[model samples]
Target: MPSPSPILLAPMEGLLDFVLRDVLTRIGGVDRCVSEFIRITGTVLPDRVFLRYVPELLNGSRTPAGTPVRPQLLGSDAACLADNAAALARLQPEGVDLNFGCPANIVNRHGGGAALLDTPEALFDIVRAVRAAVPAHLPVSAKMRLGVRDASLALENARALAEAGACELVVHARTKTDGYRPPAYWELIAAIREAVAIPVVANGEIWTVADAQRCRELSGCQALMLGRGAVADPGLAWAIRAADGQAVSGAVGWTELLPQLDAFWRIISHHFPGRQRVGRLKQWLNLLRRRHPEAEAAFMEIRTLTDPAAVDAWMARQRA
Candidate 1:
């Protein structure tokens, strides 16, 4: 039988950075991860910029837990993106991912991200350029939404990326206008899968093992990518694997999750400055509250404190 599909961690810009990737991958069950989009605008960014966004590049492009990370690039200029991809390739990332799926207005307004979804020809050019620039052994992939305003051009866009030599395609089952609302249209991914020859991974709104199973059923995709859902419950990937009869542990209860939270705090404290530290903890606690009641209480307790030392003391108390 074919091997079970891999569970990938989505590259959530601003939310899933290297620190969180370290924590979650340490929790186990993720097969691979895509780093947040490194915007390639007009110029070829310096090595520091790529290393800043994905420090894993310094460690052989693998997280502290040893999971390979593919750095994703977002842009509209085919030549500039190609140049940036070449620079990033020299850093030896596991792979390079092209982002055609970000829906942020700031990104769209600049004619990047999901804005390229409106033009299949642009998608073709961008992916083709990046693919040609990177070494043949290194994989080049693309992630895209169903379309911009609607699904009318979804198939065309998928075909363009596939024809342009994208090794794999991740379809985030919603149009640009759909935003993050419910009902991620997994069935639409099925159509995109049918249109493309490469592996199509389904993404969007998969919060639990049940959602994962249902998405697999509807999209006819074996692979699923987790985003906010994984952030809320770091063990979601492990739980999904266990549900599939893999010899793995299941859900990480609040008590079991505390250690990982502590680790997350410790890393951010060392890497981020005092001013940004507490907000990073709060940002995660806000999402953790979605899955754990204890996190709600923790969030409320530290919600008012701007002092990093106060947050540190509070964390120490929790560990106690």
Candidate 2:
């Protein structure tokens, strides 16, 4: 078979701020990045929100380091979604990603996100509405989990997205009921892939290059989308591209690690302006904690450090 394509980074709300996005992209492995969902409830999302989440639009679809970054929108109202999509298209971001897949309860309770799966007709309506509004050349895609409570409606829902003009559909395999807790059913992704003719991207449970390889073979997907896995190992897509069985092995050096961490802090620091630096770093450090068990000591060491001076001092001590 031809070489496997590069992996796309699945956006995590709050977790994927401009700082983290920049840091990860500069690490040189992520294929494409999606901005955190610009929530569009019934109101059209403001251009500032779109620009804030997807600065890559200003940089020609690439992250600060030049990796493609697509803007994503979350909303239920079809016309509002279409209008926001049209406005966002003005920036020429890669494409608009409709988030019918987010299973967050707050989003679901609002009759948006995965709750739309309960009414696949509505899902089709949103997809069709947005697809029709976007320029003919621009691509539109939808991301979704299996369904509300079970797999019974997964195929039908997947097909609806395709029939409604989604250029591609990325399926997370498990139902919304499964949420992030995994044992992600790649078989279901395979089922969805087979159910629709549009390119299907498999997501979930892809923690390592080996898992991605196996998932690609199992799901028979046109591409793979990495979520927490990429967050845990920033070099994941690079390692997978190299096809090294030990791609999961540490390619990140301590020296390289600091710069990326600094970059993340820089963006957070910029956003929060008056907010405490230690607190900013701590949020990312929490996610980074999942990868480095030793980060427990690091978190404890810096937990109380609020300002930049304290944060700088704490890091200095840790390095020493």
Candidate 3:
């Protein structure tokens, strides 16, 4: 029998920040997490910039739940990214991950993220440079999509990253053109896995235990990285593990999630300003409604709330 695969928490830039990472990891079952990408432009960023994006660096690069978080860097400049990676390595992160998969228009227009897929050689240079900059003991991993417009160069891009010293790869299973649509082509991930020597993790459109099973079967990858699905259902990782015969608890229902929601509210309230606090809670509640019917009612209750005190009152009512 093969060993059970590691389940990773994906880096979702505005959606999943340090606060949510803390909340979800506390719910248990995620093996590791990648912090939201810290965009590297033409200059090397300071340690504070990396810390701002991944405060886990200050906690020995692990969340409060002790789950390791590898910071991800997104940019097109090989030299600048390497310099920043070297600076980030000085803080002694668990590892560094490159982002070649973001589909955001602003990111692609800047010659970063999914746009790099159009030029596999650039991917190779970026990875090779960062790999050389970071210490040998620290792993250099990467995440990428099939391509900007299609899956034509998926295997070539995967091979380029692996050959350039990326220790692992996460394939999002969709192109920039796909843009979070249905029917993520898991079969294409299988081919990329066969072409690469390092471990490959399957990602994109996995929302349930059944989806997890089918993706693993089709992609032939034991590992997976959960994104929107995990946000919608925080218990997803544990549920998937339970289905895999692991000695873990099963799916977390609405009642069990209430306290986690409260904890999330408290953190955001303290860290974010009034408007942002409301927006962040609404953002999460919006996604949670997909998995929990109760969230729909909860969302409606607070949909009209624009003041922080009113949101607090709403939270208090939920607790009551």
Candidate 4:
């Protein structure tokens, strides 16, 4: 039988930085990850910015756990995006991804991100320019929503990206206006798959192994990307693999999970200090609470704490 479709860790800005990417991919079953976009604005970004967003690039573009990391760029100017893509390419990243799907009001208002979806021609131009700028061998991809305000242009946008030389496409299954409200319109993905020649990866609202199977069946996609769900349940991808008749990895209970949390704390502490690190931990725990009642209780205990080392002590006590 053919290998099971790969499960990718979706890029959630402000949340899925190198620390989370390393931690989650280390848990197993993630095939790869995309960096939280590096905004191109009107000029090429400095090299340090790329390094900061995707440090793995310096180490062969793979996370410490060995999953490949694709560096993504977001901007509206075709030439500018292409320029930045070329600069990122020089870093020898595993791949390049273009972002046409950010839903933040600030991004859209600035004529970047999902705003480009309003004009498919602009999307095609940007992707085409970047495609031509990068060498032929490197795989280029795009991630987009159904549309800015509706799903009317879903197929057109998908076609635009493919025709522009995007090797793969990931559809978030919601309109920009939908803003993650769910019922991800998986059916629309099937139509998009039919319209595009390249591979389609389904994303959005996938919360369980059952959900993953249902998304594959409904969207006719060959691969899947997990965002909040992966953060909530780190074992989600492995569970999906096991359900597909693959060998199962061991499960992670709260006891096993606490160490991973501690690892995350240590990783963040290396970069952030004091209350900043504690705040980052709270952000992760808030997401983890969805899957682990233990996380919810732990969050309540540390949510008000201000010191980073103090929070680490609390976690160490729990682990003990």
User: Which candidate ranks first by lDDT, i.e. highest?
Assistant: 3
Per-residue lDDT tens digits for candidate 2, residues 41-95, read 6766676777778777778977778777878888899988998888888888788
Candidate 4 lDDT score at position 16:
91
For candidate 4, the per-residue lDDT at 19 reads 95
Candidate 1 per-residue lDDT, tens place, 26-133, comes to 998898999999998799999999999999999999999999899999999999999999999999999999999999999999999999998999999999999999
lDDT scores of the candidates, listed in order: 0.93, 0.79, 0.94, 0.89
Candidate RMSDs in Å, in order, are: 1.4, 2.8, 1.5, 1.5
Off by over 4 Å in 3: 1-3
TM-score of 4: 0.97
Would you list the clashing residue pairs of candidate 4? none
Q: How are the candidates ranked when ordered by lDDT, highest leading?
A: 3, 1, 4, 2
**TM-score of every prediction relative to native:** 0.98, 0.91, 0.98, 0.97
- Residue 6 in model 3: shift from native, Å? 0.6
Tens-digit per-residue lDDT, 177-252, candidate 4: 9998978988789999999899889999999888898898999986999999999998888888888888876776
Q: Model 2 off-target regions past 4 Å?
A: 1-4, 244-250, 273-277, 316-320
RMSD of 2: 2.8
Error of 2 at 91 (Å): 1.8
